[model samples]
Target: MPEGYEDVCAEQAVVEGGLLGVKVGGEPVVLSRVGGQIYAIGGICTHKPASLEEGTIEGGSVRCPRHGGCFDIRTGEAVRPPATRAVPTYEVKVEGGRVLVGRRAG
Candidate 1:
């Protein structure tokens, strides 16, 4: 719905307590729906080169499958061991049943 936002998938694709991996602007991004809200973050684990889509949704965080690293889906902050770098976060919005992903968040 805004500039730099690209349609990634249907809103239903990101189910509650689940993770959806997609590419936005040629960058890997993971979309998650928690507590009825949608969030976008770098799809790769900061500690390793693992796809976060293969990870599990633990509450409001995404746990890397390769390791036990965790990152806050809302802020992209590393919250667990093995990961000390923060992943990039993106802007997300739902419109017309579609999930749109925008530029990296600050």
Candidate 2:
């Protein structure tokens, strides 16, 4: 496990092509499973005050439900219009069926 990592939820909680919302280190984060991998990113959309948990998963990207802005789940990069800023990405690892989230990636 990496330093600053905290268990967020069970690895099974994040289904394939689905999104799960969780709080890590007192900060809101959204978890998604894509292509058998779990990714963690800031929960709120950069384009507006919207929860990424409510958004839909499109391939390797998450589409914000508020304005349809899309963000890459792997890199936290804004891949669509209405969102010019990238969301914060977090380090995630699965250990013993638990999903652990670490400090934000830079």
Candidate 3:
């Protein structure tokens, strides 16, 4: 694996249309699969420090349960308010059935 990246799980651990929350090096992250593509994003809502896992996935966006705000999973864009700041997105890779997540070094 590359630097700053850690293996999260096997590909099969996250089913389609499902979300998996995990901590990588003490950073909270949420992984989800949509349209056969895996997406990794910050697990906390931008409006407040709350777990994003409480929300529901709707198509390409995940709805914030606390304020009904929505975010685009692909680009981590704040699609609705109560959350104007965009959430952080991570690079995801599937190698030999293992899922890995990491922040690319600039």
Q: Write the per-residue lDDT of candidate 2 for residues 1-106, one digit (tens) a residue.
A: 6679999999989999999999998988999999899999999999988999999999999999999999999999999989999999999989999999999993
Best of the two (1, 2) by lDDT? 2
- Sort by TM-score, best first: what order? 1, 2, 3
Off by over 4 Å in 1: none
Lowest summed lDDT over 10 consecutive residues: which window, candidate 3? 97-106
Highest-lDDT candidate: 2
Cα lDDT computed for each candidate against the true fold: 0.93, 0.94, 0.85
Candidate 3: tens digits of C-alpha lDDT, residues 28-99:
888889999988888899898788877878989978888888889999999988899888888998989989
Give me candidate 1's TM-score against the actual structure.
Answer: 0.96
List TM-score per model, in order.
0.96, 0.96, 0.92
**Candidate 1 minimal-lDDT segment of 10 residues:** 44-53
lDDT of 2: 0.94
lDDT by residue (53-83, candidate 1, tens digit) is 9999988999999988999999999999899
Task: List candidate 2 stretches off by more than 4 Å.
Answer: none
Question: Which pairs clash in the backbone of model 2?
Answer: none
